[model samples]
Target chain A: MTARLRVVSGLLILAATVPFASWWEAGLVRHVLGHVPLLVAAGALLAPRGGRPVGQPTAIAAVLVAAFCIAFWMIPRWLDAAVNSPAVDAAKMASLVLLAGVPVGWAWPRLAPLARGFVLAQLASMFGILGAVWLAAPVRLCNNYLVDEQTVLGRIALAVAVAMVVAGLVAALAGPGITRARPAA
Target chain B: MRSGGLALVAAVVAAGAGLLWWGTEGLSVFTAETARREAVALAPRVLPDITLQDEAGATITLDALRGKVVLADFIYTRCPTICTVQGSDFEQARAAIRAAGLGDDIALVSISFDPEHDGPEELAFYASRFGGADDIWHFARAPSRADTGALLRAAEVIVLPDGIGGFIHNSAIHVIDPQGRLVRILDDDAWREALVLAQALADDTAAAAPVAGGAGT
Candidate 1:
């Protein structure tokens, strides 16, 4: 399973870096969509299964790193730089994969249920707030993207935020028993 | 172990803050466009002396326009949307400058980045449509693609093909002083303020001159 997961993760990264990178050059929405796969691949590669228990401090540090990475990349100037400059683009991919994706994946299983819930809630709120700001901004936030594209990306972000919130609530209510039992069965 | 963890966390937080501070230019500029505007405003940049042909096919260089404050905007003749608004804004600005009798002190220029399609004739039509007058208002295009790109880069104007024969670009009134340095960039809607600033700069140039008419030829 681990070997297969690694292969899948590798393929995901390849798809995002090659085709999605070229495809997203023009539109902010497409650019953001392209980031999703990179983030997922990064997490999938480092996903916990039967590893030694991670220390609480390590988990907290990882979470902080991941959060900072995400926030850093989301800044408009940095986002524009990543889009325009090939060097910055490579750095963005590396940081998102290593700092954000890997850290989040490594920290996930180590975090307490309450801490996990808090992370999810924070993510949801952050997305919603960013979405609202993008939608309402009178001027284009990124120089490379059109105002219309920004609005479309904003709507997509809001949808994703809503979906995440719903998923978190469902997971919380359903408990771990159903999910854990299914894999065992 | 707990103290070690705290130290690590503190270090990460400090690093993140530092990166953020640097990335946002000390937290003063939030967007790339804003950063460009702020940087230009802080230190005015001398524009490139690219060869351009006015609507009448006469060759002109930014260096030649050193005595008069120039309000320049980038546009393509075929631009269907924002360029139209820019044209109208320029017309209003031209009228306001003339009314204020600063036409000699201020010159309005629209530079076409799409030089492939916007030749002398096309520019002439665009100028006519906006009531662009000779000398006071000029619709100009670079003679070559390379020169056009250079001017756009010098002015920090980012232009991307819309993939539909149109172009997507950020529009603003770039105010050039009497010394040919790009001193200010105003929003497309702020042409009035741009004109006012240009008049002030022109006045300052005239005042600083050793002799009357020494600034402009």
Candidate 2:
């Protein structure tokens, strides 16, 4: 798809998620997993083509920042706060969609095969771990969410983890042409 | 440069493992002790000696229960959610205490937030359904809506309209010391701790009193 189309699609999703942001399940689906990747798609499309490839240091910083932002939102306290406080919720939506996604999109294409795989693997591991925890926890972690809702979220996390793994494997076995020859700086 | 990048990747992996451990433990790093302390810290400066009416329309105050350790919880008779689970937990705790013969020293009270609906009759019905006894497990209500609101605020219980004219509130058990001081609000998971703490508080009060010297003094 064209860059403009990707941006438009991202914008459409951002708009669609606003209504469901108040609900816990919708918040996870639309904001955490949905808009995050959609916004990344837009960012990748909009990335400047004329510039030299993003350096290793900058790529690392981008991934780190994106990872941290995503991880912070995954926290039960932050998730509860977002549900209780409108300002915090808005911050969650904005930071995840804008701050996390754009940098990841810009840096991902510039990263080496090993670094890319590492990032994907990290996300997959996180989902799997958190999924297992939420599913197995006997007590409710979030004050606003019910035990059943938490379990449903755990299932979603596991499903996402599996999908991430499958996607990573597919990319790894795509072809020899998938490999980047440039040495990562 | 590539090696440094790989090292960074290694660091991220290590961090991921650490985080995974923490998450799998259900944020266990924030121990139950910490939750107890924080909940206690959030109580109001002074627990008001507010009047509460039992299901039979009998008026009682916190001061009346001062000599005993009170385990309090907020609930509405019509609540179809967490209150049920909380009530069940309270039942188990009650049984545990009674089985240990600590029933007289520790009193369990469920304060209704919906005073408009959960009047004496409704509360009585709820108490009966939940197997609450008038002498042991008392179901009470605030004398007025305003009083109920104040009590809810003082207890740090957040109540919101569920859009169906019902309310959503925290599931917690407030522990009041023998001195009538609001001490800790144990989370639902801490029911076992509540029994232990209540017993301890009662024992402390009993231990502090000079039974023989009272008449001479």
- In order, what DockQ does each candidate have? 0.57, 0.22
> Can you tell me which runs of candidate 2 are displaced by over 4 Å?
A1-20, A23-54, A177-185, B1-52, B59-68, B76-106, B113-117, B129-137, B142-172, B178-181, B187-196, B202-217
Model 1 native-contact share? 0.64
lDDT of 1 by residue, A1-185 (tens): 47677768766675656455646556788777666446645564755545888667768888888888878888988888887788888788778777887788778878887788888899899989989999999998888887888899889889989999999889877777656756664
TM-score of 1: 0.88
For model 1, the local distance difference test gives 0.83
Docking class for model 1 is medium
Residue ranges of candidate 1 with Cα displaced over 4 Å:
A1-4, A11-20, A36-40, A43-54, A176-185, B163-165, B211-217
Tell me the TM-score of candidate 1's A chain: 0.83
The weakest ten consecutive residues by lDDT in model 1 chain B span B208-217
**What lDDT does the true structure give each of the candidates?**
0.83, 0.73
In candidate 2 chain B, what residue range of length 10 has the lowest lDDT sum?
Answer: B28-37
By summed lDDT, which 10 consecutive residues of candidate 1 chain A come out lowest?
A: A35-44
CAPRI level of candidate 2:
incorrect
